[model samples]
Target: MKTLGIDIGSSSIKVAVFDAANGSCLASTQMPTDEMIINSPQKGWAEQDPNTWWSYFVDAAKQLSALVNMEDIKAIGITYQMHGLVAVDGNGSVVRPSIIWCDSRAVSFGNRALEKIGVEKCLQHHLNSPGNFTASKIAWVKENEPELFSRIRKIMLPGDYIAYKLSGDITTTAQGLSEGILWDFKEERVSEFILNHYGLNKEILARQVPCFGHQLELNSEAAIILGMKEGTPITYRSGDQPNNAFSLNVLTPGEIAATAGTSGVVYGVSSSIAYDPQSRVNTFMHVNHTTKDPHLGVMLCINGTGILNSWLRRNATKGLSYIQMNELASQVPAGSQGLTILPFGNGAERVLGNRDLGAHMQNINFNIHSTAHMLRAAQEGIAFSMQYGVEIMKTVGVIPTVIRAGIANLFQSDLFTQTVADITGATIELYNTNGAIGAARGAALGAGYYSKSSEAFSTLKVEKVVEPSRNPLLQEAYGNWCHCLNQQLK
Candidate 1:
């Protein structure tokens, strides 16, 4: 049997087929042959049409089906960009462009929530301040676009929207609610406190389903459009970061996962319920969480990572490819010869308490510094930012002695891999797994094809391991980077 996993990412749609027996990827493909568009109608805002995601998903699924027997596909799973708001009317028509995760327009709304709901109360119940999360995004809509809010019969994250399209069902998992800041961690259910504060009807929320269970089934209309069989159960769905952790076999406490895509994330699983008081590092329900076991994920997100790399490539590098830039960066020494980069340019970073300190390059020397030095500093800056947040996780008792990452995106860069390890004093493991494959395995387990989590990820393997280099020089360099970052934040 095979399970299909679809990831509706901020940049593209990726689909994978995995062997349910061994948890190995059978085939995978992404469509458009280019990145999807993220439309920003105004500064600090990010939006995308839900229909565009569906369109690419259909094309990618049909194309993946042609590479194998469609009959062999047993189930479908979806992992999507988290904290996005997708509103649909009673007739299921999209009410407007989805307010995506990184949009910072709701920062004020979230601040109001902290004041009105009381910061202590919010931290106690939601495990973080509501800070520009999905709940605040909806509140923004209700305040600014009252008419649109009136038409909204349902609100969903990007993944939930895709699942609804596939199954003709409108529902969300507890994990999804956690990402949206809608779950009350203390109560282990949706937060009536927040709902009452926002004046949002509990009925507007999707029916809550178990994070990993038989949650949805493919509809005939979706089956015909995607050329798959009807009634194929969508056994699993999760936010991309949580799914990335699940994909990395980091299910148990003390196991940690990191990903550097358009954004950077460090997700650690813990059995204990904890919250970050400042709401900088958000916590959410893990995919395997249950009322009985109570697993939660402590997530640290940096909005600017690869996007800063892309910005440099577009504006600074002029025409050099990323590979060329990497080669140039490799020529520079560890510290980039006193050059430093602050990569918070993408938007207001939650790690910095939702502050929008645009990207900056410090200590540039016109005569001494070269592009190679700037490139190296950029990569190191990203790593330093990650280390900064890891410090917060350490404070909250999710100290990771080692970090696991997939061999994709920035992890594919040797400089980034080593910098992260050396700076944080942790070993870094790179595996040959990605989110779609993880979602597939999760689907198999959720659909009861596998009886245990270990059995589900038995075939998972590591491709490489990076140990922290015992170099005082590198540590000192990171200290300097941290000092510079602290100065900038001040």
Candidate 2:
């Protein structure tokens, strides 16, 4: 038995085929050698065409088919970039380019909704302000583009749109709605209050589906395009952060998962209904959540993380490979000898109260500091920014004794991983897994191919463990970084 997992990311589309019997990945590949472009027509706006994602999905499926028999794939799972708004017409054609997660254009609408709905009511029922979420984005379209809004038949998240293309079903998960600020935690359903406030009809939203269930099956048309057998069930769907936690087996409370991709996120699982009073760290339903066994993922996200490193690689380092950059960064001492970086340039960061402080590099010395110092400073700054969010997470009872992460992206850097461990004082467990692999495992569990949920991760293994080491110099450096951040905030 086999399962196919597709992870729809902002950068690219990744597909992995997993053996259901052993949880081993048979083949994996990503489409587009370069990162997919996020079209920015105006400042603070980020959009991508849903058809572009479909095209990449088809391309990736063709590549994977070359490696294995597509007919052998029994089930499919989808994990996607969260909080995006994709509107479709009655014929299932996209109405507009998707307004993605990092876009800050909807901030004002979210703030207005927060005030209109009352902060306490929103925090108690929704667990977050409608800040830059899908609902707010839809509201933006309603107010700004009335014609487009009137033509919308269904609104879907990024994953739901992809699934619709595959199965001809417009559906979304409770977790997906929650990430969009459309799910009412108090009622455990869609938020009519938010919808009314935004002047949206409930009919615009996609039909609700369980995160793990027999959600939909591949149709003949999709099968032909994907080069897969018809009737392959897509059993699981989730936003990337919750799915990231699921990928690392961090389903229970006190277990935490961290990832540093284009953005940095620390997701901690908790059973109790909790919310940060300031609405800094957002909470949503975990992939394994249920009415009886409620699991909430408290997530702290830093908008700028790996992108800062990528910027340095492209402009500063002159196209150095990530490995070469890491090697150079490792050579520098901790603290980068007084250089500091604040990686908040990408967009409005949720951790900083939706503040767009912009990226900053403080205290540069031309005579003493080299490109190696700049590289190390960028990594340390990102780790410190995450530490800042983790501190806020601690306030909401998400104190992490250890953090689990896949051995990819920024975690691939020893210096970056060690810095995070030392600064946060949490043991870092590196896993041989990614979002695509996790979705595949989730598919097996959802499709009943595995007898138990634990059976789905039978092959998940810890590749390495990095314990926090006592280093006063690094501690002082972190303190310095914090000081710089505090000054900028003030």
Candidate 3:
């Protein structure tokens, strides 16, 4: 038997099927994807067709089924990009392109919300300001496209949309609501305060469902289209960061999860309720959160990382592959000699209190700085950006001693991995896993295949562990990096 997990990312849709008995991946594949079109009809806006995700899911699943017995798939779970807004009409048809997680179009609405709700009240109840999250995106729709907004019957995140398509059910979890700034931590329900403040209808929210329960059963329509058995349970769903943490077994307090995908994230599990005053870092309900045993995720996002690296490869490096760029970066000495790069160019950064400080490169020398030095500077800038957020995580009492990440994207770079470890003084462990695999493992537990979390992840092992190289040169390089970051931030 197996469980299937689908992760809808900004860049690609990844699907994985995990063996229930051994908790190992049976098959996994991502489909013929162009980089998702982040349509910027206006500056600082990013939107994507919700239907495109549906198409990618079907395509990826078809490819994955060729390698495994599709009939053996017993459960389905979904992990997706967070803070996206997907509105469906009465007929369950999408009304507009999804305003995705990184979109900054809702900044004005969010700022109004902060002013009206009062910063202290929003922080106390929502654990965040209503900054470019799904709720504010909805407000933007209501004000700008009133006709489309009026026809909305349900509002869901990207993952919720996928689950609805598979199971013919419309529902969301508390964890989902929290990520959208729609959940009230104090009330333990959707925040009526935010709804009232934003003048939104509460009924637009899909019914609340358990995060790790029988969320839905496969509908005949979806089952036939996907070549799956009818009535298979869809057991789990979460935002990618929470699911990433679950995949790493970072469910308990003090466990830390870091990933450098299209964007970067440092998510740490916390037992104590905490909020950042500036709402720079966000707090969301973890997949295992409960009234009795609450676990909140303190998430610090950099909105840069691999995206910046990819940009450098495409625009700056004249079409060098990521591996080629890594090779070039490795050839440069530590600290890039005297060059520094700041990777804050991707819209408004949440870690910088939603500031839109575009990326910059400094201290360029015509004779000394080669493309190798620039490449190294870019990678170091990415690591330094993450380390900056790591400091914020420390302020909230989440001192990460060891960081866990999958061996993909930027973590695949030895220079990036070692730089992160040396700069932050945290051991880095790279896993041969990603978000969807974790969701599949989670589905196995939800389906009663595993009695304990430990059992569910018994086959999960670190592929490599990098301790902070005790090399004094690394320390000196890191000090130079911190100096560069401080100079830029000031």
Best by TM-score: 2
Give a tens-digit lDDT track for model 1, residues 356-473.
8888888899998998888899899999899889999988888978899999888989988998998888999999988888788888888899888888878888889999987676
lDDT of each: 0.89, 0.92, 0.88
Clashes of 3: 0
Cα-based TM-score, every candidate: 0.98, 0.99, 0.97
What RMSD value applies to candidate 2?
0.9
| Residue 375's lDDT in candidate 1 | 85
The lDDT of model 3 is 0.88
lDDT of 2 by residue, 168-286 (tens): 99999898999999999999889999999999999998888889989999999999987888999999999999999999999889999999998999999999999998889999999
What TM-score does prediction 2 earn? 0.99
In model 2, which runs have C-alpha deviations exceeding 4 angstroms?
A: none
Pairs with backbone N, CA or C atoms under 3 Å apart (clashes), candidate 3: none
* lDDT winner, 1 or 2: 2
Which ranges in model 3 have alpha carbons more than 4 Å from their true place?
470-490
Q: After aligning candidate 1 to the native by TM-score, how far in Å is the CA of 466 from where it should be?
A: 0.7
Predicted structure 3, TM vs. truth = 0.97
